[model samples]
Target: MKNARYLPLLLCLCWGGQAFADTPLDLSHPAAPTVHVEINNVKGKVTIIAWDRNEVHVGGLLGDGAAPLSIEGSENNLSIKVQAQGHNGWFNWSGDKAMSDTELNINVPRAASLKVNVVSAPLSVDGIDGGDIAVNSVSGRVRIDARTPMLEAVTVSGNVAFSGHAKQAKLQTVSGDILAPSLGQNADLQTVSGHIQASGGPWAQLNLSTVSGDVQLTGELAPSGTMSIDSMSGDVQLQFPASLSSSVHASTFSGDLRSDFGTPKQPEHGPGSTLDTVAGNGNGKISVETFSGDLRIRKQD
Candidate 1:
């Protein structure tokens, strides 16, 4: 799910100095409570996940202002909005630029949804352990750590990394590295110009594709259907399980096939044996495709 909000995010820069609140807000409003917060910092990160308890926990810095950061709770949803006291731009033409706001962090229930869009800051989502997450960042690094059924993440100028088991996932970036802990036999991943890596644990769905990056799969995954991965300007290396079978088809317009496994039965199909021949015939699956990159399948220990 993609959210397109054309709103200008909070900008913290030097303008008019506002009074400072000696203390930050520390309160426990658990269970479907929506709390909003504002973080002022030149560099910071956000970590959110699902928990067994029913409460909302938040703690972060305030961009120099006597006015207390506003946190409004409406039912199960919490919104944390920061109001930078000064109207000055994030930085002046001085020696070095500095952020005029404080860093913001919050801990909420995993089942709750989050809407976080930042300007010139790094954003991270961990232990998603709950429902779907909708996030976007302009120049900050974006990351999601959870085992949800579905996940969608996008970043314009930062690296994207995911380390966990997932049922289904979709991630992309203009120029960043993409990594996913392989799924049971049926998982998929795609990217534009970064390296793609996935580890398979069971028999599920697997697909990896990239335009100008390398694709790698390292882990034990079930074999019934085909696992597909492709790269435009890089090599594709896949390390399969000991007992699984895979049908891989790879070809590069200019690069030669550098396969370490059995050669494909046909020449038209570069090299690489089917699931049935490697360790044993696959459970009887479908297809896997990798292009513009070298394809290598190794067994995991």
Candidate 2:
């Protein structure tokens, strides 16, 4: 009879261990129309999708040794975080290794402002509109497809791809390529040793720079927009609309300059080259400079 009494307790203990080893998560919270959402994770994949409902839903499996998911705040703002034992945030994620990876799939309001930070994990966000968005990761690819007033994504040694529109956007990486097929109006992209490719913008203001990576830009410019591109030792290819209107200025230290708008002028006594000309009404400005990178500028057919 005494053994029977302990049987339920033993079963409960075993079930508890099982639950901790493989935690199934399904949580929901009421949110405002344009609620703010913040989430942090380490070494796991996070996927965030925008939904019409005025609620936030978090689902997926929590890896072992991770602290119970921490969710705080109210309908106006929300914060979600998953940490391993002794993990004090992004700076102190080296304490525990038991939590190999935690898969997180979160759903937020369509217009919710979002900020996500992760280390060694991939992040994906899509379908958000009219709210601010920011993502930071280390050694993991970050992809975003959203339309917002402000957007920023940064990573190290991982590719960053953005396919959406924003009033203002910034994407940066080190040793990783950047691809923006549908870039926004006012944007800046930078890289240390990674290539940059951008298109689909009649951008009002655009800036692109790289240390040792090639740059390719194909798109139109706004009526009075401005663009600046700089590179060191990497080639540059720029394609503009057939009805382009800009004051083009280009210079190279020891590289070549090729353009359809005008001929490159070589100094009579130096090894450098320069191109300065105007296209259309010259309402906009375009500048390209490189230390040792060749520049090619052409008008779309």
Candidate 3:
């Protein structure tokens, strides 16, 4: 029994180390804030939590119903090799069976910068602390929770959700919704088929354009810069704090325009379909245009 137990333990250790022995990656980039990670998951959620270090931490879950894999990293950097035994391309190009052979789990520093590239999988990042982040996917939802913002999120077929505060922000999505909060001076939002919702701080200059969805702005839009909103079939909602003011140039082609903050007065040049109202003095420019929906402006308490 002693010999049997010894033989089994040695065999297991040898087999584990030899299973995928041909992998080629250094998997280490010591003490770097520029943390890089690549995940190859056929299916399964990839979750990352940030730490306070200046290094990158990585972990992943791969294959469908595959054996659990433990991913280990010190400061920053992680790699997961695809199991070659799951490939049967000559017979089937199916991931269904290949999905059950690999798995991973890891923890990373929150303030470290990240570059994540993935294929056909949803990537979720929560409690990630710092640095600018870029996430690209074939088709997946990118969820980010950061304390401060320098995040640039792009996706082809998945929605993006960013939660935190930012100084300068830019977001592009092909067909996904964007929810971001507390942006700083300037922001550029562009999308094809999804809705955009943004709010908070130092609203210096805002430019939003969409082809098939609506645009909604809430909270305090700084009274200093230019703001523009354009959409095709959806309406526009602008909610402003009491102190915010702008040079209003708002109109609708086939839809009614209504304002609760009152309107700016226009100098009479032979009145036709023109209207104006004023408070004391206007601050900046606010332009709203829509094809078929009403423009509603409200004042927040």
Candidate 4:
């Protein structure tokens, strides 16, 4: 059995003439404090960290059969692109099959702006205090831990986890779960066929929507804040403190509606139910709607 495992390695070595090679990368460029950095990767992993220095440092490895990484633009604005040679068409490009992975570890100024784009490559960003940050990925897990002014992340078919403080945040995913345990002020979350779990926000405005995915929110609402959640065939649950002051309005068709604030009024002849009531002083506004899914509002323990 040990020889059987070596046989595959021997065949791989014979077929490719050698093992996969790694090309080291160590590059640095002088950059301004408010520089804008853009990265585009097609395969492998990308890790970005914020540093106090006013320069950009990139160190990583490029695997065999992968093209050389390219860095372009100037100090004020920089762009990095990882391209694979001779792979163009969509049907011909099997992600990381013919091309080797490209792993990058980059450090930039804390005050700089960042924009990243990836396809089938996991991305991670951490410890950044900066301007607008945006990441768009296709089928790659994205994890962001930053304190920025504005943040937007979107992915398809990969999970997203965010833990940071932002003035404004917008997160969206398709067929992938989202977990935001510590989100910031204004948040807008949306998903399709994926669940959402979030907490720890005194948001001024919060909106969550899903299609065929469950939604769970537990946090404190700001005074006079507005929260709205809509779902289609998915359950919704909201947990707030006992001292919450909010006007809750919930409606559902062919689904159960239960709340700890007040009793709901169900039509005696129809297939719909609604709850319109006020809790405490009614300083905040909460609205929830669902179709064929249960809605539960509970007080936090």
- Lowest lDDT block of 10, candidate 4: 87-96
Give a tens-digit lDDT track for model 4, residues 1-301.
Answer: 6688799878988877655676788888898998999988777899999999988988998767666665678999998777665654322365447777789899999888899998888999988886679999999899989888898999999899988777788989999899988877799999999999998778889999999999999998899999999999989999999998999999999889998889888998988789999988999999999999899999998
Give candidate 1's error at residue 126 in angstroms: 3.9
RMSD of 2: 4.3
Whole-model lDDT values for every prediction: 0.56, 0.89, 0.62, 0.87
Tens digits of lDDT, candidate 2, 1-60: 769999999999999887677578899999999999999888778999999999999999
- How many clashes (backbone N, Cα, C below 3 Å) per candidate? 44, 0, 14, 0
Candidate whose lDDT is highest: 2
Ten residues in sequence with the least summed lDDT for candidate 3: 271-280
Name model 1 segments beyond 4 Å from true.
1-28, 33-44, 49-52, 64-68, 83-99, 182-186, 220-223, 264-279, 284-292
Model 3 misplaced regions, further than 4 Å:
1-29, 33-43, 53-55, 64-104, 263-280
TM-score of each: 0.70, 0.91, 0.71, 0.88
Best by TM-score: 2
What lDDT is reached at residue 298 by model 2?
A: 91
User: Which residue pairs in candidate 2 have backbone atoms (N, alpha carbon, C) closer than 3 angstroms, thus clashing?
Assistant: none
lDDT tens per residue, model 3, 1-301:
6688699889988997676343322232344554554444544456667665654434433444243333344445554334324553212235444554333343555565556654455777766555666677657787777754566778777888877766677778878888877666778888888888888665788888887767788865565677888777677788886676666666666555677767623335531112244323576667777666667887876
Clashes of 1: 44
TM-score of 3: 0.71
Worst 10 residues of 2 by lDDT: 88-97
